[model samples]
Target: MKYVRKLPATDRQLSNQLIENGWKKIKEPRNFSLAVLFSLPFSYLLGSIILWLAYLLKPTLFEFLISDVLSISFSIDFKMLLYILFVFVYMLIHELIHAVFIPNFTKSKKIFFGLNGLFGFVFTTEPIKKERFLVISIMPFFLLSLVPVFLLNLLGFLNWYTLGLCLINAVGSCVDFLNMFLIAFQVKSGHTIINNGFETYYYPMQNIT
Candidate 1:
């Protein structure tokens, strides 16, 4: 829930296990300028393209479906705002899952919340095994993104609010999707590392003395 001030004895044990398994710990950036520069544009561009395509191909369908389910009868702008709010809440929930799940195995828990330009993220500062890292990285997308999208689609009605919510969900999922790929594909390259806005760790292994 809070950033860890210091690594406790239990944290040391967890770190040890991670090191033995070739998992590495990374430091959070003091400034997020680079992360913002890299992630925000890409995420926005990709998000725009996807939304445009969805709008063009399924405008009538989306409208009908969202209208039926949300049923709020609000203006399109108001509905869009609510949808964005929902996305923010969903993102928070996704991060909370990471925080709650880690305590079961790790002694230390640290969370950083900040904006990288237009992109925002929550990440753990604690070191974890690769398996744990992978699980945490993927959990948000599966539970928060994929499931929500599927359910919303299944409901089969679109209104301004639901349409906005669906788009927000898609964007949120896209952020996680990119992160999952980085974690699954990229390995530690020297001391330089990237967080990938999910849970990917890019850093050198700390030598345990």
Candidate 2:
């Protein structure tokens, strides 16, 4: 594996930390807006898979249970708008989950927070072990999407709002998923990882040609 520094096109606060800490940016910054757009298809794909599993496991219960939820029509009413606002607020909490796990994984409370170009981020300048970084990367998804959605679906209360929140948060987690994918599959196990907004930096733990 060859390592080289690449300048990232981002105005995030973490960029400075990366430079100061002598870590090389391995890739360009991924825009949150672009990530959101790219995640929609995957979100729908996940939804389809869940639905297919439900049908395969329990067709009658699944169809009868979700029928009302599916029948509920979308409307541009005040309540609908309020639900939208709630989802937006929940998104802040989503980013906060990423922040909260930083110290646990890195053993440092020196985390920086910022928002730029439709992205809210929590990052550290310090590099972390690949396993800990993977946990931090996927924590928000488990907290926001997997737990809530699974519980709601299990309790037979999977409404449009719950489903929408799940889908939206799942889509919002595009960057996390991408980072995890790269770390788990693309990057080797010994590399140290630092996430700066959309830019993921890798520090080689072993000599690479």
Best TM-score goes to which candidate? Answer: 2
The per-model lDDT (C-alpha) reads: 0.50, 0.64
As a whole number from 0 to 100, the lDDT of residue 37 in candidate 1 is 44
List runs of model 2 lying over 4 Å from the truth.
Answer: 1-44, 47-73, 104-109, 116-119, 195-198, 204-209
> How would you encode candidate 2's per-residue C-alpha lDDT over 1-209 as one tens digit per residue?
11113323455666776677766675433665676566566567655644554445436645656565566455798998898788877787887787676645345554665554445666664567677778777887778776776687689866656767866776677667766665687566777776654677777654321
How many angstroms is residue 92 displaced in model 1 relative to the true structure, after the best TM-score fit?
Answer: 2.0
True lDDT of residue 127, candidate 1:
48
Q: Show the lowest summed lDDT stretch of 10 residues, model 1.
A: 190-199
TM-score of every candidate: 0.51, 0.66
Which clashing pairs does model 2 show? none
* Candidate 1 segments whose C-alpha is farther than 4 A from its true place: 3-31, 40-59, 62-85, 103-121, 157-160, 173-178, 188-209
Report each candidate's C-alpha RMSD, comma-separated, in the order given: 8.6, 7.4
